[model samples]
Target: MSSQWSQGEIYESYVGRWSRLVAAEFVAWLDQPAGLRWLDVGCGTGALTTAVLTQAEPSAVVGVDPSEGFVGFARGAVADERARFEVLPAAELSTDAVGGAVDVVVAGLVLNFIPDRPDALRRMREIGRTVGVYVWDYAEGMQLMRYFWEAAADVVPDDRERDEGRTFPFCNPAGLEGLFAEAGFSDIETRAIVVPTVFESFDAYWTPFLGGQGPGPAYLRSLHPNTQTAIRHLVESRLPANPDGSIELTARAWAARGTS
Candidate 1:
């Protein structure tokens, strides 16, 4: 079976560190009871899984991801006895493998990467004890990529064509609510969580993409060296100039719950 788009190293590199902050905020919003069993789908380096284990004080936490590298890193990083990592895709989760119903299923910034998201939601509902799930992605109009693309547009008009290459499946709020409803979840709620992604300099912002960890990296790789240099220069000039030199990007997500 093909892995989800998030399995690629490019997407992972850009979002990996930031994922910890995202998970922490999500856990804080949940305020769920302690000792509940939790499942982390597309767990990536298990950032959200670790956050759930620590904040929710869950009885146990199991994190699954399609990337072996991510699973390996997660296993090495999160050593709590209650937490475990597995190399599995979100679509493959089942009651038998999880050993019955889970109290909550969490997928942080992962839904958009899955092509068959509705099916994945169905699987999550089937495995969840109490249908509590958190899903978030880049909001369409407010995406951080807007800054990057703006810079690219100045240097290369064709960049816009490439930018529209793939549709971000979860960029719309109504689409998210509808997906959950179709999956049989009730009491759905959506909220915006903003995190300030501060970069010390242009290098600080651009270096992560060099690692080929996300869409930014992919876009960067597609450009010629001269074009890439021009894009960076334009981005730096367009950005708010500051001595401290930082950029703030807002992340929005939807949280929904139900009883199975």
Candidate 2:
């Protein structure tokens, strides 16, 4: 099933919350000097844009995403006059779109979703002097989706191909670095950013999957109700839960940065 990128609130509850944590670390790692102009491509719900504004202290930022729902939600959630959001696709990114040259261009947990990555990266390079991006290590260290996909495979082996780990193999460091290099980005560097993801209860963890905003949730919604129940139960069983019923896991993202 194709992933649904709309429904900002549901996406936030499902994975945008974790995206916020990863975005903070990503911004810190970029360590760009203050007062730079930034463009946040695929800035879903302004998580990365907010991070850039708060952490990097950019002079101005323009966040762009294809989803109007996400852009509207971002505009509402982020009240800073220094930040503005637009409903535009990564492929359409340009200096004119952002109003001026950008010092830094960053995408958090979004590169893998863009249909034409090379075109998007080319645009990012043309408009900004620095480009940095991050995506979940979905094949391994993104534990939340990893556990869910494992259970999904157990329930429906034929559907194993739908797992993001399989769908987004390029989220790894080597692959990310390669993309940057191919895009003519110099001084490319890659790192892993890990953060704790503690779910208050199985419900806290499982309920988000029903939100139908991303790949795992979209897949779950595609299955029969009984099949969904089976998968959910299996996921609960396999997760390492605490005596108090909380689930603790770590999410890792591979980040890459390069000079244009």
Best by TM-score: 2
Best by lDDT: 2
**RMSD in angstroms between candidate 2 and the native structure over all alpha carbons:** 1.3
TM-score of 2: 0.98
Model 1, range 128-202, lDDT digits (tens) per residue? 855545544443433455667767767887556545223564545577778887887777766666566666676
* lDDT string, candidate 2, 93-114, tens digits: 8888888898999998889888
Off by over 4 Å in 1: 1-13, 131-143, 161-166, 248-250, 253-260
Clashes of each: 6, 0
lDDT (C-alpha) at residue 121 in model 2: 86
Q: Once model 2 is optimally superposed onto the true structure by TM-score, how far is the C-alpha of residue 61 displaced, in angstroms?
A: 0.6
